[model samples]
Target: MTRSANEYLKRILLSPVYDVAVNSDLQKLDKLSASLGNDIWLKREDQQPVKSFKLRGAYNKICQLSDAQLAKGLVASSAGNHAQGVAYSAKKKGVKATIVMPATAPDIKVEAVRNFGGEFVDVVLHGTSFEQAKEEALRLSKEFGYTMVAPFDDEDVIVGQGTIARELLEQNPDLDTLFIAVGGGGLISGISVFLKQLKPDLKIIAVESDESACLQAAMLAGKPVPLEHVGIFADGVAVKIIGEEPFRLCQQYVDEVITVNTDEICAAIKDIFDDTRVIAEPAGALSIAGIRKYLRTNPMQGKKFGGILCGANINFHTLRYVSERCELGEQKEAVIAVKIPERKGAFRAFCELLGGRAITEFNYRYSTDREAHIFVGIKLREGRQELAQLTESLGSNGYNSFDLSENEMAKLHVRYMVGGRPPSLLNEKLFSFEFPEYPGALMKFLDTLGERWNITLFHYRNHGAAEGLVLAGFDIQDTERGEFDQHLAKLGYIYQEQTDNPAYKFFLSDVNGVFEK
Candidate 1:
């Protein structure tokens, strides 16, 4: 028989063992509410023991297993939190649990799963993706007689997730909407059914990363479709396909599914960190991203809304990329990739055109094209129109430019492309200096150079430190070596001239310290 939403609600109401879940708080989001001009609340499932709502589902599912099934043991696959949830629940119920997780899963998650007493079957690095790992888990389950405890598809799991709704309504009965991150549609499916049954008019908005939007794709395709590729950044919710059971519930109960970019999700993570001093993993912070987009089109008119921070399992190496993109997403920083001729006077003219914006990164390369191209990064003004004028002026100066404001590749690796040029000649010069933190350091640096020789490459970082570092590359005109020496002496700053160093490589090398190797 097909399970009904009513049945899930009955399970929550009747299950005495699950009453503890009813105590989790539905918190008023004072800051987000003020920002959106709406009363926003958060179902703080991150406060749970496993640091996510996953525990609820795992506990519910494991508790409902028959004695024979429990004796047979259970297994599940997850990148992080789901594994911990299942492990914690199985240990509590005296059930033998074996978890299958990707080899790339975070060290903390792996440790946490072990801490919960779940035996881990470390599989061979078979698949390059999470879905393949999941398939392997299913195969192992069938072959080993272990019950497959799905992360989000089973009725018991949905009921466990729905318990969050029970707690949420008990605390804030007037909530008009709830935002929940959708991975395989388990959490949102459960919450949607519970919330819809309790308050028929309450809005359920499903938030997902655009690159890993399985539920949204499933809804649009009218069935579960395997995604050709899934983003690994939001590891927690980077599901390739929606669970068949949860998709049906989402279709019936979820009001809408909204997609957000990885950049937006990272920005939301930063926002949460700023407000609550809490560091959320990418998937954990995605629900707020939907609420932000929702406020753009629909004013809440002071109606109450809430979002759940689902899980935190971000990789440490990935944080740097997320930080850079989040700054761009919030418009606090800007990156531009421009191609300028490697000729005298052209470099100076381009720099002079950037009257007010600072230079964040300036690097050059010898392109295969006739003209050597240089990529200069500029900091944009706070006002959008001011930034537009700066780029327009760049275009006017016989240079072709592309904004890396939303480009993932450029932010991750292209900003450090400054070491491809051949060694400087006798008359060439290089200087590194610390400039005072200011609004127009780039423009000032150009003014100081005074339209002299061609600038071969430059790199600067304005990271709110005591001072910013500026590295400039110049092609000297037919001047003597004495003039170049005098120029460096006049600057009176600690510096290095790497033109003669054998460490120079055609591409970015470790010796140059220009790019991330």
Candidate 2:
């Protein structure tokens, strides 16, 4: 174990990170501080030229390479941020750079790398994941004479990341705790070594996504271990294994390791946006989410805490999922599945029980003669306790309800699959529509359609974009085709008929002749 805090301190001091990286601001988070009753500060590394802290380490490592190595150029593999970092650094150093990225990487990130590196970077999309891309990069490095740039494992990279801690301690010397997001563990390992040696009393906490928690796993086993499966939602920090060097540093200097779920990450994104008016990638928001959870469990009041806002290279399409889950993540919404009698007044009675809190989502289909299962989402004002009370109230009123708030299957799949084909429906036509996303746009759509035709099935989800996607089924006979066409023209929305879509046929079609409505 060649883990020397003093040696790391010297390396950090001499690190050439500043040549290509910004000394990011340490901004005070007033709203978060007021809510938690503590002094909260954010290390805004997301404001870097690459829109991530990765440039510091990448540039530092590249600058340290021998003249021969620089002349040969460099090769690296990254999911997104590190690729951008390497590309930008290589462009600045006037070296040829080849970045191999996962085919699954977002288009925005790939395009940014090309634009940032200009004539210096060659981006190759080869594999479906980072690990595979990394393997290809290594193969190419051997095949050619290009030097390989490790994303987070190398000593120079770790030292470069440590520079953040130097800035943090200088900016806010009174911090009691620091929260850092951990993937391959470079950032936390670097920060922990520097801060622990400098301020022995300061707490260093490592935050990781529960789906890809290699750091927590390594800490438990006392060695780096490969995770069998990793979630890709927070693709920036979705490492399957911790680096050996980073693991050793973390084992020695990191105070604690904690994991947060997808919802918590989404909620943290919302929190950051509220304060900084900036949306963070899920991985970037991991530290803030961990901080919130720590405050909940530890209840430290009036203490100084700092969280690193690591990166902000989020894909635009992912905002819809983040927005939809944020409310549930904050415990401000509860999704429940209820079984009500198929009679007409059961839905009305269930609404009465709800008492007008707010309906975020409601999906139902008459699938059976005796009972109908409805998936409903209600806006929560109080918290989880309100959800519990609502569940009890439903039972007392003779409605059978199952809380789906914590059910991952329900949230991701079943909610959208709420309406399957029923046995009695006649002349059902499925159509897809896109409307300008705005307040009351859905209501306007429904109002314009009116009660002229019975709605058999409907699905609409807001993806936090310019337009909203909707799938609808209506009972329209061939005789009423002309009238339906006129209604669509009057609505003036982009529409497509998906009645024959294979996905609908396989999963939603009442193939057993069970249609009864």
Return the top candidate by lDDT: 2
CA lDDT scores, all candidates in order: 0.70, 0.85
What is candidate 2's CA lDDT for residue 10? 89
Estimate, for each residue in 235-306, the C-alpha lDDT of model 1 and write its tens digit: 788787899999998889888889988778877888777667677888898988888877866855867778
After TM-score superposition, the amount by which residue 423's alpha carbon in candidate 1 deviates from its true location, in angstroms, is 12
Candidate 2 vs. truth: CA RMSD? 10.5
Q: Which portions of model 1 show Cα errors greater than 4 Å?
A: 15-22, 118-128, 299-301, 339-359, 364-386, 393-400, 418-517
TM-score for each model: 0.74, 0.82
Worst 10 residues of 2 by lDDT: 508-517
Q: Residue 109's C-alpha lDDT in candidate 1?
A: 75
